[model samples]
Target: MSTRHVLLGLLASGPSHGYDLKRRHDEQFPEARPLAYGQVYTTLQRLVRDGLAEVDGTGSDGGPERTAYRATEEGTRELSRWAGEITPPAPFVTNEIFAKVVVSILSGGDPAAYLRAQRAAHMGRMRELTAVKSAAGAGLATVLSADYALNHLDADLRWMTTTEDRLTTLTAEVDAA
Candidate 1:
């Protein structure tokens, strides 16, 4: 997604300076990965030039003079349009959990241990992603692209659960050995 759209979405919430947009952007996505500060500021600048943002100089300190940005009507419409078009990110670009699990397996610790640790991580992530998903549920309605993302998570969760269950069964069988 264009950073301008991201900035617009953040600006739609309220007037904010560049740093504020950075914080909101971080909160919108997981911190395990982040949008760079450069991207944030650059996008904010573009939005200002695009007429989507206005400088609210009413509140600022003397040093560097924090320029508060408010969304213009055009900006609001653009933001709303962008919001309606919100879709899940591409799988290769977004789903690192699966990749992490593959790396864990290749790194060659005990498979059971790896699976257990992986399960723990995904479970924790699932909780976090879930909260974001719920809060953004409305945006997700038209976001058919999210299905691939959800599918990847769902598969990982199931793989972990099934592996855990199978490991338990195998442990019982091994004890009989």
Candidate 2:
């Protein structure tokens, strides 16, 4: 994920201090990893340096003064362009499981056993995600993110099953080369 872009987008909402930006980011993107305070400040500094953001003002609300940031006109344009752009679908398969299976075959190890263990691990994660998605009061963002992950896990499980069924052929092919 583009941290700078995300921060700019947040600033587009309004001028906000680093603490407020970090809080809003977590609340807005519950599925994403939480941003660290240092990361938020660092990204904010870079955005200011790049002319995408500027310091709006500094004020104290009963404590230490904090600088608030706002997106510049250029930042707004950039954010709009990024939001409209399409994310390209993965063009190549980088299946670590497949690589491991081939490696196990080449090394005289039990590929079937490895697949079984991997499948079990995937199932466990799916169950956890399912529970999160099904929980009452789950927001749309949370549910959607969980669904996205579940779909990928399902695809991987299907591939693992198919590969296990074809282990004999795969083993022979690997042995030949």
Candidate 3:
């Protein structure tokens, strides 16, 4: 996810302090890890430097003065363009787990055991995500996010099972090579 675009979108509502922006981001995107204060301030500084945002003013609510930021017209346009673009699905390429399994086979290790362990781990994570989804209430964002992750994990588990079945053939092929 583009933090730059997210910050701009938040600013579109109105000018906001960096702290408020972080708070709003956490509230809206609860599934995502919360942004650190340093990250928020640093990104804001970059936005100001790039002219995508301007430091409107500084004010304080009984604390240290906070710089308020407003998105520039260019920033709003950029955010609109980003919002309109369709994010492509991630390519089905070899990942670390696949690489590890192949290497294990080549090294005469137990690839089947690895797959079993991975499948168990995936199942555990799926259960955790299911619990989170069940407790998410009617929040569409949180529910959808959980669904996306659960679907991917389900696909991974299926792949692991298929790979486990073919481990013997894979080991033979690797030995021949």
User: Judged by lDDT, which candidate is best?
Assistant: 2
- C-alpha lDDT of candidate 3 relative to the true structure: 0.91
Please report the candidate that would top TM-score against the real structure. 2
Q: Is candidate 1 or candidate 2 better by TM-score?
A: 2
Per model, state how many residue pairs clash. 0, 0, 0
Worst 10 residues of 3 by lDDT: 136-145
Off by over 4 Å in 2: 88-96, 110-153, 165-177
How high is each candidate's TM-score? 0.46, 0.68, 0.67
Clashes of 2: 0
Q: Estimate the lDDT of model 1.
A: 0.71
Give the candidate order by descending lDDT: 2, 3, 1
lDDT of 2 by residue, 31-97 (tens): 7999999999999999889998999999999989999999999999999999899888887867899
The better-scoring model by TM-score among 1 and 3 is 3
> What is the total number of backbone clashes in candidate 1?
0
- Runs in model 1 lying further than 4 Å from the true structure: 58-64, 86-177
Model 1: per-residue Cα lDDT over 6-97, one tens digit each: 77877877888887788778888763467787887777778779888888765546666576888899999998887788476654544565
Q: What would the TM-score be for candidate 2 when compared with the true structure?
A: 0.68
- For each candidate in turn, give its C-alpha RMSD to the true structure in angstroms: 11.6, 4.4, 4.7
Question: 1 or 3: which has the higher lDDT?
Answer: 3
